[model samples]
Target: MIASVTNAATLESAFNAFNEQSALLESSYRELQQQVASLTARLDEAQSARHRELLAKERLSEQLANTLEALPGAVVVLDCHGVISECNAEAARLLNQPLLDRPWSEVAKREFAPVDNADGELQLHDGRVLSLQRRRLGRDLGEILLLTDVSETRRMTEMLARQQRLSAIGEMTARLAHQIRTPLASALLYASQMSPGDCSDASPGGKVVARLRELDRMVADMLQFASGSNQDDEGIDVALLLADVAETGSLPMEAASRVAVNIADSNLRIAGNRGALKGALLNLLDNALIASGDEGRVDLGAWRDADRICLTVSDNGCGIPENELGRVFEPFFTTRPQGTGLGLAVVRSVVDAHQGEVVLESGSQGTTVSLCLPAAAIPSAQRAPERGFCHA
Candidate 1:
């Protein structure tokens, strides 16, 4: 009976140990499940952030595409391999392509040349001229090409060349006139002294002499307008410049007696060749007076703006045609019966030398010439003469 009791106690102890180990295992499995849930939540949050970043990148790319497409000038974007990635509408028009994704040589075969320099002006095979500007897109990306059509600019250049030629011819004509005037005048005086008895029955010398006299006067005026010799580099008061031009070039008091000259006491100053400025102002005043004719009004004035001076000569005369307005500043261009056509041209040249600009506004009512010049320094310095002005 004692042996049987001992065996039963030993079995009971083994059963209790087994039950405790099973409970401990169950608790460990629950803790492991909780740790797995926490890790899964963190992974899910990271994925959401990654997705948002990808979406933002896509939006930015779309915006960039839209902006490139809307630009006015031709724009071409290239990849690192020098392959074209995208092009704008203007690029398509310039290259004559509906779309461009191939290599630049394939798309702009006729237009592409070895990019010799960073940027330059080039003429296409199709007779189109463009100013090409290039910039690196990023640290390692390819470059961007910006092409600006300069065909109109070339046309204007040709027009300016023609005008310059005409002006040179006018000046030559004036010099020739001056050279012949003295002799021609003497011949006319001698012919006038001769009587009918000394000449033949036809009296041809008298008629010839009369024509020569008229030619001499025309030549003198031509030389005066063409010489453009009065432009000497000197400091000039804006108000005094206009006043002197009026006193010198204005029509006789008897002819345009009603014309008025008004000057403002703005004390504006210009650092320029005095002769050039004076001549330009005089031409402007003359144009105003001639346009107004007798009984018309001409107003001359000047004022100061921040770091600049504005001089204006206005007239109540016949205005210019719209089409001709663009050509007025061109050399040897005129609408007058006896005009040498260099008045405004000389004016523009002079103003340009002073680093200034001349704006012309003409209409049916009248015309106004505005000259904007950079103000001279408060304490002036002596400087060398400037080259003649060239306006584009």
Candidate 2:
């Protein structure tokens, strides 16, 4: 009976051990399932974050492309090898050539011509000016080029410079006029007071007085030009004005016979500053006489053309060089050795003040300068009393 009880006790111990092992395996399996679920959720979150990052990067790339295309100035991208790889529409239009895949050096040579004395600028075949700038992308990437059309900008700069120079000249001319007027008047007074015999029209004293008067008139012209206007407008009879100009003997005594005056109608009239107009005409006459020389012919003619009164000075001497005609009215520009370079400039100023137009035509044949002024009504009287003639 004791042996049977011992065997039962051993069987019960084996059954308890087997039941404990099964419970431990079930707990381990449940923990493994929870860990797998957690891992799967983390993987999904990572994939979603990666997708969002990719979309943001794509949007940024698109914005950069749009900005590049919207630029006004030309933009060109060159490969590391100095070949034009890409460009905007403006680049193509400005360069006006097929630019893709072309060597930069070749394009520069083919489409661009270097401007004289200008660096970093080039002129195209069509005369448009472009300013160029180049920047390296990196040591290994390539370079970017920026080109801007500066034609209008350059023109405006040149115009402003010219105007500034003219302003300076006007100031200097005013000072010069002041300095010259006092002595010139004193000399003229002295010459006028000479003895009666020496003061005859043919005498040397008379000639000296005439020359002094001419000098005084020239000073007045300088002042008028510097002041920018005559400031006095009146009815001027063309015939009487021409008669006075002829009587003034502006032409040298030797070349007096070379001048011929033609008046279409003695009744034609113009409203302007009498002294200013006289000076302008005499100045033109002197230029014509000089151009014609001692033997050549000069014609001072006036006529009515439509609503305008046309006054012309023509010469048979060696004509103005075609290239110089354009610059004749520019201040301080002249071809003569002793020229003050103010004659035509003064004429232009006077005409502008009077609201007139001046045109010059020249060639191997000869030169003709025509001044077109608006025709004015004839005064009720024969002449409007005004300041005396400039050269009288």
Candidate 3:
């Protein structure tokens, strides 16, 4: 009986301990569940935040790509190996081809012509001037190059400089003209008096008179060139202009027979100084005649091209030397021994004053000079004289 009671007591005590441990275990399990739920919520939040960040980065990357494409100037990126790694559309357009993976040196050699005495300034085969700017991307990365087209700016700068030089020359010539004309006139008068008897070109007195007259003409040309063209907004008739130039040119009979005039529209008119235009045309006609010689043909054509008047003087004879063509319009530059060297310069000044452009083209066959000027409308009341294109 005693042993049975002791066994029951031990069993009951064990049962109570087991109940207390089970309750403690349940409470701990609930606490663990709560911690797991909190962690899961935090994880979800972190994932959401990360997704938002990724989207924002993607958007930023797209924006940067669009911006690069929208840039007007070229943006080229080179790898450490000096190969074109990436480039904008403008880079391809300016370089005139695809630029990815090509070596920069090869592309430069093929497409770019380095400007003499100009660092970082290069010219394309198409005659575009590009100003290149370079920057290092970072350590061991590569380089970034930015190229901007500067052809028009360069042309304007050169034009301005030339105008300044011409202005200075004009100022100096004005002073010299006064000093030289009086003595030149006195010498001409004395030469004329001495040459009263024999006036042939072969005679000594005649030669003196001829040389003096030539000098006088040269002085007159100098004064006229220095004066430049007046800003006269008079309407000039093209037909009448050509006729007057033909008459004034006074080409020899043999040379005159080879001249041909083609006027697309008889009513074509231009707004400029009449005398200046006429003088310029006469000079070109004279030059074309001289180039064509008596056996060759010269063509003078005028027509309305777009909003401009297109005039061309072409000849079939020995063309100007390619090397000398660049300096033909420069004052005091000439290949002819007796050339005044101011004829073409005067032509240029006159055209510039009228806001016109002149271009010279020459090859082995012949030479042609083209002039473009803004066309003008004739007044409603002023009727253009009737005329037809003629061949001389």
Most lDDT-accurate candidate: 3
Report lDDT per candidate. Answer: 0.71, 0.80, 0.83
TM-score of 3: 0.68
Candidates 1 and 2, the one with greater lDDT: 2
Minimum summed lDDT over a 10-residue window in model 2 is located at 383-392
Given candidate 2, what's the lDDT at residue 134? 92
**Taking the tens digit of each residue's C-alpha lDDT, what string does model 2 give over 108-171?**
8888876584466888878888888999999989999999899999989988987787788778
Error of 1 at 139 (Å): 57
Superior by lDDT: candidate 1 or candidate 3:
3
Model 1 RMSD, rounded to 1 decimal: 14.3
lDDT tens digits, residues 98-156, model 1?
Answer: 44567865666666544443446766766667887889989879888898888888899
TM-score of structure candidate 2: 0.68
Q: Candidate 3's residue-wise lDDT over 157-192, tens digit each?
A: 988887787688788878898898899899878987
After TM-score superposition, what is the CA distance of residue 132 in candidate 1 from its true location, in Å? 27
